[model samples]
Target: MANETKKSQKILIVGGGTAGWMAANLFAVHWPDMEICLLESSDIGIIGVGEGSTPHLKFFFDEVGIEESEWMPRCNATYKNGISFVDWSAIPGFNHYFHPFPAQTDDIFTVPAFFSSINARMQGHNANAHPDHYFLETYITAKHCGPIPTENFPFGVAYGYHFDSGLLGQYLAEKAISRGVKRVIGTVTEVILNPRGELASVRLDDDSFLAADFFVDCSGFKSLLLQGALKTRYTSFKENLFNNAAVVMPTPMYGIIPPETKSTALSHGWAWKIPLTTRYGNGYVYSADYITPEQAEMELRQHLGLLESDVTARHLQMKVGRVEKHWEKNCVAVGLAQGFIEPLEATALALSFNTLSAFIKCYEKGGYSNQFEDAFNNEINARFDGVRDYIVCHYKVNQRRDTPYWKDNAANTHVSETLAQIIHFWHRGGDFAKNLYMNNLVGSYQPKSWACLLAGYGVFPPLRSDEHNAPAPSLPDMVQLGDFIRRCGLNFSAHNQLLDHIHRRPA
Candidate 1:
């Protein structure tokens, strides 16, 4: 028996969309001396609708040395505070609710205070006031202010960006190539497996065979290498998440680009409106079981005030599931190649980044051990399942009964035991902060995020008779909070002004 270790030096990445380019760039950045080759075909177009992202994207930019000034204007990027969900609840005339970036303020305890105040008011102890009144972060969003960073409050503003995915891929490709990554423009005609059943090489359409010690499947939903070569099984989430198709189109911008992504609940599923510098990225995510793509498009056109013939919409089929194993036999899946949930909370980019980050960490510590693989698969699976549940929470908590879709989601939607347990504990007023800390179910949405969705939809547990409801914050305190928000808003510029500033600034 040979007692030797094989280190991965030559790496081949299949497909070159955002995920492919991102993997190439990050791997090159970390392992500059390693030979990294990305194979992509120009004929195949990318499903580039994943524009919105979470704050974790900032880490990727910083690590790769891509500054905001450089990528922002080029990608038509605009700052994103968080998501604003409209008409999700059954309550008539309830306009909207915000899931703002975690409140950034000196008063870290203010969230608990705000929660108490909102609960007290909702219990009829004080005059009704919107929940945003107590939290400065949500209040800033309500004021339509960009979450710009200030000297004293460096981390006070939490934000991400909405950019053109195609442009982003181009930007990253340039960066990756500059960092010594080889770019090969060719289609992967076949994946060749070694006698040991591991990915040995890939055959390009040009009749060339490229071999590498490791391979990354960024081939999007095709899963060419991981599933196609390794025969990895997939676990579907169709029962829990009903959205399997999306109708996407671009509409001309009417006014100022808001900093928040607007997700409006429709009769079938939901519609997303993401503002870019030049246009609004619009899409309707719905279940095929409930409505056909043609019907979905009609509903989307009606929502956007467009005639059926006015817009030429693109239809996307989404596989609402993840591969049984992300890291299988020297090949790992990233982006849509691994799994995809609907873009309810803008998690696509974050998931890609996290998966790659985890793989890098595993690779660094003696690559390819059973122990490492087990831990990696466990964490990745948990993250995916957690995200699935979070998205499911949105549909389950909706109070709407107007349509069969809403009624079916509220009554018969599949609920995971993990999510059900979390909800149970939350309803019992169990230590939310503690559960959020300990569980750490998903990377993107935390307890505060869950609180926003749960409370926004008017989903609450019955109050125990012995529960002592604390009085709402005093008038003076409320006034003080309002003043604080106003001062913070002064520091942060308007959303459009920030975009203009970024565009005008010298790269």
Candidate 2:
């Protein structure tokens, strides 16, 4: 007797936004002979506010053969070095900090050592004793007007992009179609399931059936195939992440576009400003329990120094959670269909890309066995849970007492056991590099990121005897680092100039 296991050949992707097109293009690129079909409805509108991204996006672009010149101009994209957080703590002028990309230096110190040097320097009342002094990317952002052009930055500059999300989807769609992936435009009316609880096919509005060996759900928050057909439940993170809604709008660039995303802490939540080539993608993410959509719009307008009539805002009810399982049977959910945790760190696109990449690898190697499915589930769950904890850390360590929202969050924000353990370890002067919870095999926010948050919130660990008594970097060494940053900034061209240069070159 022979085994009767099904092998995925024809893949039907239901959804047509960034996640759908990304999956299609990735599949088409790696498995050129495989049949990949993407279904998108012309009547549906995309929630295109995910304008910021992590460095991982560069890998996706390279894999799909997308040139910066090809998509940058088309999407009004701009370079991003890292994120600058303002007023997260209630320390007045002391609250602002930069969570820069990893420094490109061999002399990087451990978190405790770095913090010790900063504290020692601050004790001497040296005006230049800030954390930014230790990072070269900060200088690149301050002087070069953006990140360095090279992907491999020997100078320790790591960068990503801030672009129009809708335009990115269109760009990926064009590339995918050019690579021979089929595209169908229609709304899904029904999801058909087989007896074994597997996705059999999907019915379009025209009453036509589209069947495939496997289904990929990029159907945004609806989870059409995975949750709708397979009946997968969602695990809400509302308790951990309290922001349930957002009001998004774009404003004209007032001055030169900065090379970093700006996240300003609001009374109830936070406002993100992502500078593109032409306009600024802005949004205020807030908890509805503390404020209403109409009030949020008013607050956002005030924050941007705009009147009610200056700009039109789009209100969105955010679904702050993920599905019970990212993959079940033959159906896998990606993008918003998988889950969302606001846009605090711009993990939306990164998460989708990760799921697609992992799924493809698992299928190619193991052919989707029960063992492989279990492994895939564990991996995605860890990713989502890890992200959730990191985001919660930002809210948990805040010392703000200005508003009810901040007050409540500071007092009542829940922390997972994993995060709590990591915090405890930090308190004991443990090295962050040794904590598995702070770092992962696949994700953005690393232990260094956590260190930034902890430092910003003034949550330093007790100084160990070795660290407290250790010799700090000499004043001359500090001066040299500052001089290097200044020179780097002075040597790099302005960000707008770089954009102009790229645009002028023949594509």
Candidate 3:
């Protein structure tokens, strides 16, 4: 267990945003002595409009030693328990539900029964369909505020946050600087490589050479470092998943904001309503081939009940795959430089965090060891593939046939092999009891896959009694369950009050 004279390695991180700063901060926090430097082009703007996040963020905070109070206010943070879906199937009836975070019970695993009951109600089998009355998602959305629920879990139940992505970048940059990370403000003019098929350094716009033993790419969609400099071929996920273009806008709140992000399916695509502490983050993710950006933006505006402004419309395009090899000779791509699946669920940031965590875990054990690289690449692939399957399940499971977009896209969509098998398995009344041997197996040991994709998309077991061995009892009504959830806790504040809270707090 002798340490190889640990080389004081230098790391150069490209770009600035949640990904860049998060990488910079992670490196600075874990390897304070290493020469960790971040290069950001002041002229290049970031797509900081992604305000919603998954609950794994709390773990990310713990890793970087960031206190909630300190960064929360500065970043316009708001607690998020889960996401609610409306009109995803485009059914005429009142079909709406939520996918809550990982919730467990000591006495039971009631997830299947819950879904079965709801599905029965939807299918008109059960007269009294009260499936999700006991869940926190139904309760929290009713209250509109996100005070921690007094659940059985003592360590605190799962929760994410809605925050200003730009402010988060600044906050992490400051923290990284405080921890001895050098910040170089300049655009990368050129990439210098060595004869060993490795990146040597990058030249800044000021004609300065910044050398490093390792490079981390956070250059958003441009993929400047890993893809551009290293020439790593990009893998296409267009066939596996659809819906590429997104029209994003940050608008003022319409009324009392909900603690959960709302993803309502539309004629052409889908719209997202993420409630930050200050304002509402809105977007419409649609296939550009099917709907124009202007039309998508217009749909988003109509949904939010607002008009276009300076921050009203920004278009984003992405393919749903990552590089074949995240780590080649000496550089690793993180964030969008790595890959992006459209945000049906808010997972972009969480994926970034896990990618960085894998890098740090590898480096911490042994710097740039091939063992670590293989393992990291495998983990990254698993995470992305698992997510890809889950997202694919959403489109396939939906019964929506309202518009040409949903109809043609869903019907003609080329599903991945994994998703096709999963769909077949579900149609045949398969339970989630079996193991998933796929590369992306839904995180370390958790069942977030079921909680998010299956439940969110309304995929249920054919038998309601599969969840428990005993005879199934009559469940409460949907309205009664909704009322019970409202009584429990989960509320949001008025937009003005939430904004005031953000302004008064210090970073």
Candidate 4:
């Protein structure tokens, strides 16, 4: 046992969906010399209809070393600045608010002025009436589907991508291959395990057994490698999330492109309208105990202003949350195999990216030691739990009580400790930090925490700020911001053109 030679590291990835390929590609990119193989069954089909991404997508692209020009057109992705939640406040015609990506703040100058103006706006006076006008998202999307210049915002704007999931998987696979990731095609019919309760190898249906030092479970809902072989326990989040089913559809983009993703609340749960360059990816995420698939589909159509037959729907059901430990034994679960949280705020893809990122850290830091794996598992679980809290907060913060769904949630829901703390601070007019690492920080900043629930849910406090805090901003500075935004000469259409120009440039 003295001076033992190390076992050569090999990573066996099960499945080829977005999660699988993403893990495979990242493994290949990070460890080009390591043996990396991805197994996907040709007979298996992907449920690509339920595809959308959060802004962390840029991180994925950067990590995998894919250029935007190379993947953007290939993925048929659309730039999404942020989600525009409509009618969640229960107010008619005026319930729109944005959760913009974290902007590098000149807090010294901007924060004081912003607070003063928001207070004025709350008081019935339209002081600079268009608060969002100063922000880039609203204006940029309006100008021909462009993104804000990456140079102008050094820290990167909060943005998400709307893409065809299947295509994205394929694109990622190509990237993995280019980086020397081996591909194995077949259905996994059996799993071989060592007495150590770790996966030793996976047997394909064709009778070939492939062995590896480590495994990644990207096998979608079946969790063929992680849960099936390891018997990992999936924690149920139904009480908090409630929504367990989805009816998804991909319809052609009818007209002008919408720059933002739209989530509208219904009696049962909520429906999402994600506009890609080519089509609108629509889905109704709801609780089956509350509404039938038929009812959910009907509701989605009504929300989209369509008739029943106007849209074809596919039904999907899933429990919220993932195994208590995403990494156990020698295998790790990525994508749906890890867990799902009903796609609210588009955290699934981001979570998948994070899962790979965590594994990379483990692989690089300590060559997959128990210490690293335990830390990775703990961090991943914390992120999902934090997101769960945020999503639940949306339901809890709603002013809607007309429907049984809304009423039940309002009366019986419990908010998470982290969210409760953030809310408490928000009530006192404090800005949420970008670096709150509940488990590990989900995003560098808490972008979701910045959104004004006060404005979105019609919770106008008696006073915007009590006396004796910071001196009320002088009127001149407030006017300057509004004037600066108006005269900033930021043209979104030009930004769109820049992306197109980048795409067209000879690579």
Candidate 1 ranges with C-alpha deviation above 4 Å: 1-8, 106-109, 118-130, 367-371, 435-444, 461-476
Expressed as tens digits, the lDDT of each residue in 1-507 for candidate 1 is 112243436889999999999999899888877789999988887888898988878878987888898999899999888888999986643457888776557245456655655455444444323444555556666766788856666447668899998999999999899899999998888889889889899888889999988899999999999989899999999899888999999999857788889999998999999998888999999999989999999999999988646678999999989998999878989999999988999887888999999988876664444347767888898888888889998888788999898888888638988788667656665456566577754354666777777767766533345434653344336666677767766677677777888988888
The RMSD (Cα, Å) of candidate 4 is 3.9
Q: What is the C-alpha lDDT of each candidate?
A: 0.80, 0.78, 0.71, 0.71
TM-score of each: 0.92, 0.90, 0.86, 0.87
Highest TM-score model number: 1
- lDDT per residue (tens digit) for residues 1-507 in model 2: 012233337889999989999999999988887788999999987777799998878879998888888888888899888888888887644488877876554145333445555445434323233455566666677664767544333454567899999998898899899999999999999888878777888899999999987889999988888888888999999998899999998889856779899999998999999998889999999999999898999989999988756678999999999998998888889999999987888888888888888888877667444347778878888888888888888887787889988878777637888778766655655345455455442244566676667766665433345545555543436566666666555545688888887666666
The list of candidate 4 runs beyond 4 A from truth reads: 1-7, 92-94, 105-112, 115-134, 142-145, 150-156, 308-310, 428-450, 463-478, 489-491, 494-507
Pick out the ten consecutive residues of candidate 1 with the lowest summed lDDT.
1-10
Error of 1 at 422 (Å): 1.9
**Candidate 1 deviation (Cα RMSD):** 3.0
lDDT of 3 by residue, 1-507 (tens): 123333557888988878988998888877777888888988998886778888778889998888787888888777777778788754333367677765542113244445445444333343332323446545545555563544533433477888888898888889888988898889998899988878898988889899988889999888988899889888877876678889887777556657788889887778888887668888888888887888888778778776644454778886678887787767889889898887887888989999989888886777445457777888888888768777776776776877876667678557777666655544443234243434334343344345344544445433343445544445535575555445444333333455456557675
lDDT of 4: 0.71
> lDDT tens string, model 4, 164-216?
88888888888888888899999988999988778998888889999988888
Q: Is candidate 1 or candidate 2 better by lDDT?
A: 1
Q: For model 3, where is the 10-residue window of minimal lDDT?
A: 122-131
Error of 2 at 351 (Å): 0.9
How many angstroms is residue 13 displaced in model 4 relative to the true structure, after the best TM-score fit?
0.3
